[model samples]
Target: MKIGILTSGGDCPGLNAVIRGAVLKGIKAYGHTFVGFRDGWRGVVDGEVLELPREKVRGISKQGGTILGTSRTNPFDGPNGGAHNIKMTLVSLGIDALIAIGGEGTLAAAQRLSQEGLKIVGVPKTVDNDLAATDYTFGFDTAVQIATEAIDRLRTTGESHHRCMVAEVMGRHAGWIALHAGMAAGAHAILIPEQPVSAAQIATWVQEAQRRGRAPLVVVAEGFIEQGQEAAHSGRGLDTFGRPRLGGIGEKLAPEIEARTGIETRATVLGHIQRGGVPSAFDRVLATRLGMAAVDSVAHNRWGTMVTLKGTSIESIDFDTALGSLKTVPQERWDEASLLFG
Candidate 1:
């Protein structure tokens, strides 16, 4: 069988590892040929492909980002979109099955395409770790590690200047990255979309930290909302998924904190810095495991299903189960982390 593989959505660490694991396993165990789709669903729509062999995948596990490239292109759109058109394209390209590695949007498209008679297996990949089906996604650990390191460095600078530093991490709807990284970095305050906080309240936390002679550190998620207001909007327009661009909340709060508390304040947007560079050991191993599990699912002809991590084990669950809802940071987690807050 010739399997077509594509990495869709935002690029992340461990993407190359996933590709390497799948290709190596497919070639050695089943003699299955592989083709990589470039720029995600756009590649599928345009039938753009690159050949994949064992040699092509050598030593990619330690590498960051997808060698095959990626994009946020939606497969159900455009002239050659929808299930029928995609199936016709696949037939023309001789792709027997598809392994779609991506987050929510990509897997949702894969689920629809499978419903429309395409053979597809999904491997969950989200730096946010928001998917409900998996205990954790492949890129989440790497992102957290990056964010944590950035916050740690920020802490040192904040102390040096006696400044209140607000560090923003990526999180559209959930706060897993911000929560874990903030706690790890000993942030004085943590803000997330799930918890709306007022600028005044944050100032109080800053003042309290200042009282203790500590430079205050604040970690905010991109989608976080100030109290009694909507979430911060980037005004940069929406993506292909029709979701608003979320960011700049930390920047917005920096002035407010400085004004209310009269403290020297700075806002550092971690931005795409969290997405680039080598994945942590945890992420590489998890991504490789999911990649191998995805191919094994394909070998068994398990279509419309995705491989997910369930605690210490990697398991397969129906795509709907995974997409039913997002896995958010629970209240208990926030409360536990808050105990250390100023």
Candidate 2:
């Protein structure tokens, strides 16, 4: 059997690990030949490929980013896209199956392709940890670790200047990154898309921290909004998935916090730093497990299925169930973390 693999959407840590795991497992266990589709679905549409031997993927499990590359290009767009074109392309390339490693948008596309008779399996790859049917995605741990480290560094400078620091982490539809990082970094406040807060409330948290003679550190998700306002954005156009280019919330919140709390404030957007680094021990294990499970599912002809982390085990489920709903940070979790605020 032959397998084609691609990494889609935004790049993150543990992506190379997934490629390594799938390629190694498929070759050793099933004797499957592997080809890599460059730059996500565009490679599939344009018939771009690279031969992936065991030597090609060796020692990449510790590396960040992807060996096959990635992009946000929607597979349903353009004349050469859609399931039929992709299926024909796969046939001509002599590829028997595919393993798509990505987040929600990529999985949704894979779901449509599977319904249209494509032999494909998915490995969940969101740093946001929003995908359902999985307790946590591969890159989330690495992202949280990175964010927490950045926040910890910001804290030292904040205390030296007695300034309020707003650290923005990535979380579009969910608060997993912000919530975990903030709690871990001991931030005075944690803002998220799931829980909107007014500038006044954030100011109050800052003031309380100031009164305690501690520098205030506020961790905000890029998608966090003011209580009555829309989600934060700088008018940048939507991505291929039609989601807004979310960012600058920390910059927006810094002035708001400084003005209200009478403290000098600074904004630090962690941005892609969280995505570009060596995978954490946890992410390496999780991504490897999911990737190997994906090929196992493909071997069994589990079309339309996605390999996911169900508690401690890696399992496969249909995309519909896997993409059913986002795993947003629940109110109870926010409530529990709220006790530490300020």
Candidate 3:
């Protein structure tokens, strides 16, 4: 069987590991040939591809980002979009099955394509850890570790300067990264998309820190809109590829908190930093497991399903179930983190 693979949405650590694992396993175990589509769905639309062999995937397990590249192109968005033309491209390329690795949008696209008669298997990939089915996605742990380290370093600078350091992490609809990172770094306050905080509330947190003569550290998610300011006419709904962006909440909130609190505030947008560099030991192992499972699923002909981590084992789930709803940070988790806040 000729299998096709593509990485969609934003890049993250452990992506290359997934690719390497799949290619290595598929080639060794089943003798299945593999082709990699570049720039996500656009590559499929344009039929731009590269052949993947064991040599091509060597030493990519610890590498960050996708060796195949990625993009946020949504084929289902417009009239002449790439989604409509994918079938013809697949036929021309003689590709039998697809392994789509990405976050929500990528999984949703895979689900729709499967419904449209394309054989696909999904691997959940996100730094947010917001997918409902899986116990945790591969990249989320790496991102949190990176964010936590950044916060720890910034804490020293913040205290030395007596400044309110606001470090932004990535989370679109959930605050998993911010919640875990902030708590890990002992942040004075944590803001997340799940909890839209007001300027006044944040001001109080900063002011109290000032009163205690201690610099405040705040960790915020990029998608955390400040109350009514979220729905305004802004470009917060598009990705870097200019397809429905999902950032800028911390950029907007940082200035507001500074103005309201009268503290020397600064915003550090982690942006792509959270997604780059080497994968953690945990992520590499998890991604390798998922990749192996994905190859096994392809062998089993488990189309339209995704490989997910359930408890101690990797399990298979329907693509629709994985993409059905975003897994958000629960109130109890938020409250637990809140206990440390001033």
lDDT of 1 by residue, 1-342 (tens): 999999999998999999999998999899999999999999999899999988999999999889999998888788997888888888999999999999889999899988888999999988999998889998889999999999999999999999999999999999999999999999999998888888788999999999999999999999898899965647678877788888888888999999999999999999999999999999999999998999999999999999999989999998878786998889999999988888
lDDT of 1 at 147: 97
Clashes of 3: 5
lDDT over C-alpha atoms for residue 65 of model 3: 90
TM-score of candidate 2 to 2 decimals: 0.98
List, residue by residue over 206-281, the lDDT tens digit for candidate 3: 8877788888988988777676674422465554545556555556666777788877778788888998999999
TM-score (C-alpha, index-matched) for candidate 3: 0.91
- lDDT tens digits, residues 93-198, model 2? 9999999988888898999999998999998888999987898888999999999998999999999999999999998889999999999999999999889887
| Every model's TM-score | 0.98, 0.98, 0.91
Q: Poorest 10 consecutive residues of model 1 by lDDT?
A: 230-239
* Clash counts for the predictions, in order: 0, 0, 5
* Order of models, best TM-score first: 1, 2, 3
TM-score for candidate 1, please give it.
0.98
